[model samples]
Target: MWIADQWKDYEVIDTSDGEKLERWGDYMLVRPDPQVIWNTAKKHRGWKKPNAHYHRSNKGGGEWEFFDLPDIWQVHYKTLTFRLQPFQFKHTGLFPEQAVNWDWVCGRIQKANRPVKVLNLFAYTGGATLAAASAGAAVTHVDASKGMVGWAKENAAVSGLTEAPIRWLVDDCVKFVERE
Candidate 1:
């Protein structure tokens, strides 16, 4: 069980009633979590008046109710910066728990004596790509969605990795893998 406890800009405040209240930078968001089965008391005040709430529908989809939330926001993890936006599937474009993975990715690339090349497939928002690039790896980030690839580019720029060796490609991972 890897715990991502190094986050200063993101925190899981509390969990209750199939929902997790999270603090992303300056905003609080209530999102659904299937693992939170226990009906714990929602002691956190952020649960009541969060900046945004993703209400899940029993019909197989959900909708976000906003309360003064911006269309986009930024969060930092170590030397990386990620742009977050609540899109389909209740995703905020970035997964805070993946910070642990990012740390491992960075460490592996840094430990490599020579220049390393990383191929990130289905690289949603380029979390791992940025991590590898920050550690001096030339990374090729591939994703199926063009918007997601663009979003990753913006994140790279904000994280000061715009000059890093990264190749952004918008392509289906399966097809790209087969073609490559």
Candidate 2:
């Protein structure tokens, strides 16, 4: 198993009784996880008083209970950036796991020495787009959600990559790919 020691703006504090305690940047949150079946003693006080909690419903979906959290906040992943917002679902618009992939892609692009043109399909919030742009590559970021595209733009701005050659497109990924 490959273990990653480097994590950007995210941390797994603890896990117990089908739940995970995590710290995203400065905000701490508790959410359910079926993989965490082992009951463990919680040591961190933050777990008891999370800024937000995700309660799973008996039906299918779940909801977030906010104790005290801002409407929106900012976090950074190296040169890439993201906005964290509490929504109906347990999502903060950015996936920290992709940092490994971003590093690989950026390295490859930099080593290529040629002008790289990348097409990022289903580019949610522009994490990959920003990574590629930061590596000095032109990118076409496509997503189905307009709000996600807007969020990506915000990320680009925060990363100081607004002038990077990134073309944002909001359209169905399948249809767009088929037309190409």
Candidate 3:
């Protein structure tokens, strides 16, 4: 399994009782993680007074209990910027673990002497897409969900890549690939 540890804006502070304590930017959050089956000691300070805690419901969904938290926020990973909001399913509009992949792909793009073209399928929020564009590659970001594509666009603008060479498309990955 590839675990992304090279992150400056996000960190897993601790895990306990089927929950993971994470810090996104300056905000600390406690969210349920299915993989956290071990009952470890929650010794971290963030575990006790997190900015938000997602309380799971036996009925299938969950709700976030906020404590002095903003409705939305922004976080940075190196030169990339992402908007974060508490939404259904307790997502912060990003998977911070993907930072490692972004760095790896960006490095490869930079090393290549010629112009690189990237096709990001199922490009949720366009993290990799923006990373490639930021690394001087022309990128085509494709996602089935329009809302996610819009979110990715917002992230791109926030990262000062609004003028970057990116083609945003809201289409099924397979259909888009077949057309290309």
Candidate 4:
């Protein structure tokens, strides 16, 4: 299987009992992952004293339990920066695994001599949009949630892409595409 393992800010420290111990920057987190079906040995020290843990609820949703962790933290991929926080549904507003995709997209945009127009659907925290903009592409970031769009805008601003050609749109991607 192809692995997206080139990460400077993220790592899967260990997996055990349907859970994963990961390090996001300097903070360690324990969270459930269905992909980790193996009940392996959890000998990692991070597991013993994680900075945060996302407890999955049997009813429907889950909650984050914090231990000396900040409400938000920053991580960088190349020159792009992302504000991460343990939010609902066990999300830190960033996905380090998708950095490879961002790199690939940026490469394609740079290869194109002419101006490139990119439409990023479900643009969570503007990672791809920022990457496209950094690569000199005009990007339109779209997400159904207004908050997500706002977060993406924040990411853009932080990445020095605030003056770049980026439009944050809060619209259903399917409907937006149909209208387009």
Indicate the TM-score of model 1: 0.98
Q: For candidate 4, lDDT tens digit of each residue in 49-103?
A: 9999999999978999999789888877888888888998888898778888988
lDDT of 2 by residue, 1-180 (tens): 433336667888899998989888888989888899899888899888999999999896699999988888887777777887867567777777777788888999999979999999999999899999999999999999999999899989989999999999999999999998
Instruction: Please give the lDDT score for candidate 2.
Output: 0.87
Off by over 4 Å in 2: 1-4
**167: Cα error in model 3, Å:** 0.1
lDDT string for model 3 (33-83, tens) is 999889977888888889999999999889999996899799998898999
lDDT to native, each model? 0.93, 0.87, 0.91, 0.88
Estimated TM-score per prediction?
Answer: 0.98, 0.94, 0.94, 0.96
Model 4: CA > 4 A from native = none
TM-score preference between candidates 2 and 4, better one: 4
Name the best candidate (by lDDT): 1
Whose TM-score is greatest here?
A: 1
lDDT of 4: 0.88
Rate residue 8 of model 1 by lDDT.
95
Model 3, stretches more than 4 Å misplaced? Answer: none
- The 10-residue segment of model 3 with minimum total lDDT is 1-10
